[model samples]
Target: MTTTPDAGLRQDRHLATEIPGPLSQALMARKDTAVARGVGTTMPVFAARAAGGVVEDVDGNVLIDLGSGIAVTTVGASAPRVVEAVEQQVREFTHTCFMVTPYEGYVAVAEQLNRLTPGTHEKRSVLFNSGAEAVENAVKIARAATGRSAVVAFDHAYHGRTNLTMALTAKAKPYKHGFGPFAPEVYRAPLSYPFRDGPDVDGGAAARRAIEVIEKQVGPENLAALVIEPIQGEGGFIVPAAGFLPALQEWCRDNGVVFIADEVQTGFARTGAMFASEHEGLVPDLLVSAKGIADGLPLAAVTGRAEIMDAAHAGGLGGTYGGNPLACAAALATIETITADGMIERAREIEALALARLERLRDADPRIGDVRGRGAMLAVELVDPATGAPDAELARSVAAAAHAQGVIVLVCGTYGNVLRFLPPLAISDAQLEDAFDVLAATFTELS
Candidate 1:
């Protein structure tokens, strides 16, 4: 069941010092020396503890958590059931490596994923350690099943950082720059980006456009999979136009191309449904999931038609640490909590609250070009009022100002001009409104 935040944890923001504070500053100095330059941090403060909707820094400062660690802690960071399950699993055993000895937890998690992922046809699931790994495995399974090479991705897509996924990803900076020599046979197509693509271009037209590009560029017969985020995450939480996903799925079905839904960030009730594909009544040939699967533990899965999933040879699809027992245990409990604790309804409540607050902010502020997303995952794109050009600098400034005031915020998008909000579903309404108060003030001051 869902438990309240720790008694000692206050559901309010408390600034003991400017953002990083003294302890966090000292820790930053040590981090600078010890951590790699490639690693990045959004909030400078080091978190000592986090519960419900608040994160406590080492300096005794309390900050409202709006980012949810990039949408990982949906059930909340210290979910009681998840913690208890992890502790019990640790006491029993940490790892037997599912590939080595196999375990019930692994099978149980696979069973849960199979039942939860979209589609009622005979299904199968394989667990991995991260979103990227699950995505890579999906691609592998598609290619194996279809005996095709080329894969099609879309614009404004952020799959992951691994080489194969990097090639599949569209952005060039940070995620792809200097990481060339990427995997081959990965092709790109246009997405139904409504804000920029204009309102006249409906989902059907957009799907035709994308399909035409794929046909002209990469023949459908040559394609093994067409992977996409149902509601693009990291790519600024861009929700595709209505009918767009359904049309694409239809095309994939006719063309014999495996349609893969990369629900890594949009799955597990984050989008007010078990999976975002359900929003369009679309059932993908393969669905990759992670992030909120195990609350905070590392676990991911690729669930799809049994025949397709079994395409890979007996030993072709597993890592040494894939589906570790602890992660599996945590995932089972996380799923149970989401089902029993009414987290899905909670997500819808969060969406209503966030959208109402954000709409009011957008109505008053000309810089907010658009406000779009589903359920708990939402974002506002910043743009110049007069020229309609992206205002990434203003976005950064607003995020920094919010950080100073003890509200954790995140910035994303291809142009780095989108401010995304992903509060935990377990966070109280009071805590959510308090965070927006800071956000509204930040926008007022910065704009």
Candidate 2:
């Protein structure tokens, strides 16, 4: 018989059995029968409960979570403050459909986003249920404000799965494959991928190339918004070169094109800063946020300049469950937890610890082509040492090995050769060290 753990999940790694133990295997079998094949799971192990840095699966295996549910639980899965706020709010009311009966929680979250996001200028926010929704709304606002139809996205970018966002995204295999007849007027541009482009193509040069392409093909007059991820999420944790973002932002400013920073994965202190845009002092016309916004709640927002946001007509941007009361409450509590509990400092600490270990690994292992990312968001691109080619097989093997050993890591990138790490700030240094040790051993064993 299966048994649940204590109220507080133990913050330790304990593999009771193989990765997918009997209980999890049984559950997976059930899921395979009941669930749709399109919906995928990274790990077959089913989670019973999670807290701090560990997730206890149905088989009683307490695995160290480095992925953080795709960087959703920055404050941990069950942050006390968030739990308390959600509990209280759920008791008070679950949903009243903000568009129908406005609530204070929704307005409060909007206010917090406006005050916390980069610029000090007068701004407004519109809440949504997911990152794709936020992105779609941002595009709507940009088009409405500029009266233009064309939008531009960067290479290796992952906007979302919705029709418009799918058109905006650059990848083809999983996200856009089979789904045909995408939304129109979406264009793709090259990104400043330092690892691939080499050091000679500096940020400014990359920006100039992209700007030239935009000018020649898309044109400033037709482009409504130039949407990009400050640090691309699904397309690998690709961080643009130093001056790349600033130059592009300047270009957008001169051309009157709305610049949208999709901080869905990089925002909320995931990059050691409250927002990744802060690293380059970027004040985008629109900023999209989600994932860590409400500490695991399904909430997202598009915060932007008042003039641009006001362009959207009344009732034009909203949904039935846009800003659920419980989600809003959780967001407020999460913001407090991040600020009051020094989550930003914690993220920096994670970065220091992770980078040091990853750099050491790279120094010894030729398979590791590059070690990059900031704060808790880090990754290593695995390649064939002999030919310097992406080794997707090696990436899959490493991730499988890590899962077998009770350390949860994720693989991503356009080439599927990147092993990304996104541990929660709540994870302790000792836990991170242990996870790294496991990764090192796994690499050694594979080598």
What does candidate 2's lDDT look like per residue over 71-108, in tens digits? 99998888888888999998899999999999999999
Per-candidate clash tally? 0, 0
Residue pairs of candidate 2 with colliding backbone atoms? none
lDDT of 1 by residue, 199-252 (tens): 999999999999999999999989999999999888888998998999999999
Which candidate gets the maximum lDDT versus the true structure?
Answer: 2
Candidate 1 ranges beyond 4 A from true positions: none
Q: What are the C-alpha RMSDs, in order, of all predicted structures? A: 0.8, 2.8
The lDDT, on a scale of 0 to 1, for candidate 2 is: 0.94
Give TM-scores for every candidate, taking all chains together and pairing residue i with residue i. Answer: 0.99, 0.98
Full-model lDDT, candidate 1: 0.92
